[model samples]
Target: MQPILSLDGVAKSYGGVKALTSGALDLYCGQVTALLGENGAGKSTLVKIITGIVHADGGTITLDGKPVVIESAEHARSLGISAIFQEPVVFDALTVAENIFITGRPLKGRSVDWPTMMRRSREILAELDPSIDPAMVLGRLSVAQRHLVQIARALSNDARIVIMDEPTAALSHREAEELFAITRRLRDEGRAILFISHKFEEVFALCDRYAVFRDGAGVGQGTLQGMSSERLITLMVGRPVDQVFPKQVVAIGEEVLRVEALGRCLEYENVSFDVRRGEILGVYGLIGAGRSEVMHALFGTAPAETGRIVLNGETVSIRSAQQAIAHGIGLVPEDRQRQGAHLRLAIGDNITLPSLGRTTRGGFLSARREREQAAPLAEQLGVKMSGLRQRVEDLSGGNQQKVVIAKWLATAPRVLILDEPTKGIDVGAKAQVHRLMGELAAKGVAIIMVSSELPEVLGMADRIMVMRRGLVQGIVPRSEATPERIVKMATDA
Candidate 1:
């Protein structure tokens, strides 16, 4: 079969560092190709090269068997290439139809036709899903609805090739299924799809072909039809990963945290759980299951309307995040980019932000003290960077996650709440995080892990607390927990 798009020896470099050593791929019409790679394996760089966010240093990019230069994102879109990012871009204040037509509205006789815009938008939206109203404001729509709107906008552009990057990262199982259906329809309609995701199940379920990247180079490409899952992993990591989810059995100690009758209107109610020292309590739930909400309240990011929080058998009032930190609690929020890291700061500065007081000399911070504290944490976390002076934002997603974890770990918190700690990270990074959790648990830190991935919950948690619609359904021990059981608990009313 002929490729709709092909990139040969596409290369990119940054400050003498190679970002894409040999970026290569082939996207065929009527097929969904899974782009597999660890974070920093050049997948994102290749995406940028294709979309013209950045120009390639050297390569042959061919569209329709003819060499071409993608001058810009606008040029790529004009040439039937469109990308849907993990975070859907939409104008919140604008109507759904307005957002769809923002790129290029249909022409009317001498002026922008608002009515025709809305009408055409509704037609395009119906092709994906009809639940969204074209005239309705986009801000009121759900994330899933916003995704559909983005897809509708792409189709409106007459896009022949679509790139979906981690589309299911934040979606529930049902929502993911809906997206899969839409993706398959697009494939059947002869649109070439490039799907980038870290999930094996999603790739197997939705993609027809597979291509892997390792250390900024294309390592493998083939049909996924008879590919073993293990072989896929080996191709991605460039080596055998002995343990994907490394969990350790640790000695349980005194109770570290206890929550009873925790309540927040329209979020969660009557939530109760206990975390003992050296134990990981995994919280598993659907998107709106209030897992993050409960953790937010516990971490003091959002105080609960009513609840009893006990720390070390003593009742403590945590009115804010400062108080939570002061009381030996730390939270690595779900959205690390916006909520966790200070992007503009250096890696060392971010890691030492919470421990500023400890790094103070007289009345001001000591640079030496800060570096001393940050260096060990960064090294311990296996943060790959030139130095601590590098901007945290410049690091890849996995490295950024490491910095976030290192930041909180610098504080030496007795209780840690991690919300989707490994979301969007590579397999190696995920395994490293799991190993870190095991180490922390062994050291008697009461950990509360809120994750959407069932495998993570089952592999790491000593006990799983399943929540459904703002309530705890059941708490099952690791021995008794399975994907089916946890899913049932998460979905059942």
Candidate 2:
């Protein structure tokens, strides 16, 4: 079958750095093609080039076997290509209907066709995503709903090709199912789908054919039929990644962190959990289920309306993150880029920021001590950088996450709280993080992990706590916890 879209000898570069070398990609009608790579391995650059967000330095692109010049995003869209980015690009003030038909609204003689737009918007959105209200503000909707709006916009434009970059990254299993359903509908309609994802399961489930990129070049390509998850990781990283989850089994010590009847106004209530030294307590919930709220409250980033927290067997008042840190509790928050790291700072500076007091003499940081302390931690975390002097901004998503982990680890907290720590990282980094978590737990540190990914929760947690709307649904031992039951509890009122 002829490919609906094809790139031949495509190449792009930034200064001396090659984002993508000469490479070929094909996406056929009624098929999904997954583009898999480690972050900075050229996947994003390739997508940008294909979508005309960035022009290729050298190559040829053919749509329906006809050479095309896609110089801008508008040109790409006009050529029937649409992309849903990793981070959603939607204006908060606009209604769903308005955003969907922003540029291409049906017109009636120099006047906006309000009635036609409303009717058509409702109809098109119902076909793509029925649950969303077209009248609702785009920003007011959940991440999943906004994603659907993006899809509706593409469909409304009559796009023959759609690119989804990490679409399932933030979605729950239920929301992902809806997305998969939409993908099938698009495929049946003969649209070419290009899927970019880190999760091997998602790739296997969605893509008919897939390509792997490594070190700025396409390394492998084939049907997903005979490919195993382990083999896929091996191809992407150029090394055998035998296991994705490297969970550790450490003997649980005495309870070091305890939450008693924790409640945050209108967010979470009566959330109670315990984490013993040398133990990992996993918190699982759908987005907006208040898991993050409870964690934030515990860490004192958000105030608790009513609750008591006992750490190291002492009842403590944590009014701020500094107080929590002083109490020997460290938190790696969900938004690492915004909250965790100082992007402009060097890798060593970020890693050592939390424990600078140890390297300080009379209120001044000892540069020598800071450098000496940070080097080992960065190395231990396998952070890829030229040296400690390299800026954090230049690192990949996985490496950046490692820097965040290194930052908190330097604090030597008795209890550690990680909120979506492995989020947006590659498989190799995820495994390493899992390994590090295990090592930290083994050192008698109590760990509380909040994650949306079921596999990570199941694999790493000594016990699982499932949360629903503003409440703890149930806590289960790892041996008894399964994906189905966890999902049920997470959605259960």
Candidate 3:
């Protein structure tokens, strides 16, 4: 079968730095083709080249077996190609109807045609979701709803090839399911879907074919039916990873953190859990189960109004993150892009930011000490980078995560809080992170991990604590932490 779109020898460079050496892909109608790679492996560059955001240094693009020149984003849109980014690029000021019809609102003799636009918007959106009101402001909708509007706009524009870049990165499990269903509908309608993501489970579940890129080159491309997840990881990383989860059993010691009836009105109430030295306690729950909220209170992101937090047998009141740090607590938030790391800063700076006091002498910061303190952690975590001066934002998703973990580890806290540590990373990276966690546990650093992936909880956690409506449903050992038991615990009151 002829491909609807194909790229031959697609190459790109920036300031003499080659971003892509030989990028290539083929998108066929009625198929979801996954673009797989590490964060800096040239997947985004290829996407940008196809979307006309950046001009390729050298390549031939054939659409329907005919050579075509795409000069700009508008040109790509005109050719029935549209992209929905990780964060939906929608106009917050405009209503849902206006956003869907922004490309070409129905014109009426030099006047805006609001009625026709609304009707058309409603019609297109009805296919995906009928509950959304076309007249509602785009900013008023939830994150998932905003994504739906983006999809509706692509469909309304008569897009034949749609690109989804990490569509489920921020969505909950339930929301991701909805997006997956809509993607299937588009595939059934004969539209070519290009799905780019880091989650192995999602790629295996949603994609029919895959094009794998590694170090700015295409390594493999084929149907998903016969491929194993390990092979896919190897292709993405150019290495044979032994195990994705390197869990190590350590002797659990004295309790490092003791929370007594931690409660915040309307969010969570009477939540209590204990973490022992060298142990990882995994927090499992559905959305609104108050998992993150509990962590927030524990780490002083959002303090609990009523609770007694005892660290090392000393009752301490942590009113801010600074105080928490003073009490030897560290937290790596779920949203690494926002709360965890400073994107514009270099790796050394980000890692040593929290431990600046240690790197200072007589009220002056020591660059040598900063490097000495951060270099080992980065090396131990196997952070891939050209130099310590490289910006954190330029690294791949997995490397960026490594930088985040390095920052917290530099503090050398007795207790570490990891919220969704491997949210948007490849399988190999996930394995590396799991190994790091196991190593940390062996070093006697108590870890509190909050995650939605049941398998991850079952794999790495010493104890699984299921939360429901701001309460602890049950705490079970690893031997008893089955999916059925966890699900039941999460759903039960």
Q: Estimate each model's TM-score.
A: 0.92, 0.87, 0.92
lDDT per model vs. reference:
0.91, 0.87, 0.91
- Model 3, TM vs. native: 0.92
Q: Which TM-score value belongs to model 1?
A: 0.92
The residue-level lDDT of candidate 3 at 366 comes to 90
Query: Judged by lDDT relative to the true structure, which candidate is superior, 2 or 3?
Result: 3
lDDT digits (tens) for residues 284-399 of candidate 2: 99888898888888778897989799987889898898898888888888999899899999998998887878888999988899988899999999998999999999988889
Instruction: Compute the lDDT of residue 9 as modeled in candidate 1.
Output: 93
- After superposing candidate 1, which stretches have Cα over 4 Å from the reference? 93-95, 108-118, 135-140
- Count backbone clashes in candidate 3: 0
lDDT of 3 by residue, 99-137 (tens): 887887898999988888888988998898899999998
Q: How many backbone clashes does every candidate have? A: 0, 0, 0
Task: Give the Å shift of residue 328 in candidate 2.
Answer: 1.1
Give candidate 1's error at residue 142 in angstroms: 3.4
